[model samples]
Target: TKMLRHGEVHGKPLTSKQKGLFGLLAGGGKPTRLKKKRDRRLESR
Candidate 1:
């Protein structure tokens, strides 16, 4: 369900890297700096 929802929102399937990041997040790791920066850019847009 998570993968399906992610695909629906992004309009494409997740790549291995993206899936790995999602796994990291699900496992309670802090968001990486790059991910935080990207999220900031998206929010600014």
Candidate 2:
């Protein structure tokens, strides 16, 4: 994974929680409720 590779390069491996936060900050966390709302809207169409 890019995050793991990044950690390796930086010499600081991130924990699962930290990876989750990184994903959130990068706007790649589709687990957010906003993603669900967008999915619902698409389905309604």
Candidate 3:
């Protein structure tokens, strides 16, 4: 929902946050980077 709305507005990708959050919840795997989240946020802007 967030990514869809963001993609509609910004015409850019908006998925890393969702992916990172999902990865956190899922647990036990490779870690996600904060830089990725920051980059995605900047792109959303």
| True-vs-predicted CA distance for residue 4, candidate 1, Å | 7.7
Kindly indicate the candidate among 2 and 3 with the higher lDDT: 2
Model 3 residue 14 lDDT score: 49
What tens-digit string does per-residue lDDT give for candidate 3 at 1-45?
Answer: 454434433565647776566556456554457668888999998
Which residue pairs clash in candidate 2?
none
Model 2 lDDT tens row, 1-45: 587448643677688777776677677555676678999999998
Order by TM-score, highest first: 1, 2, 3
Query: Where is model 3 more than 4 Å wrong at Cα?
Result: 1-14, 28-45
Please rank every candidate by lDDT, starting with the best.
1, 2, 3
Q: Which stretches of candidate 1 lie over 4 Å from their true place?
A: 4-11, 35-45
| C-alpha lDDT score of every prediction, in listed order | 0.73, 0.71, 0.60
Look at candidate 1 and give me any clashing residue pairs: none
Lowest lDDT 10-residue stretch of candidate 2: 1-10
Which scores greater on lDDT, model 1 or model 3? 1
Quick one: best TM-score, which candidate? 1
Q: Which candidate has the top score in lDDT?
A: 1
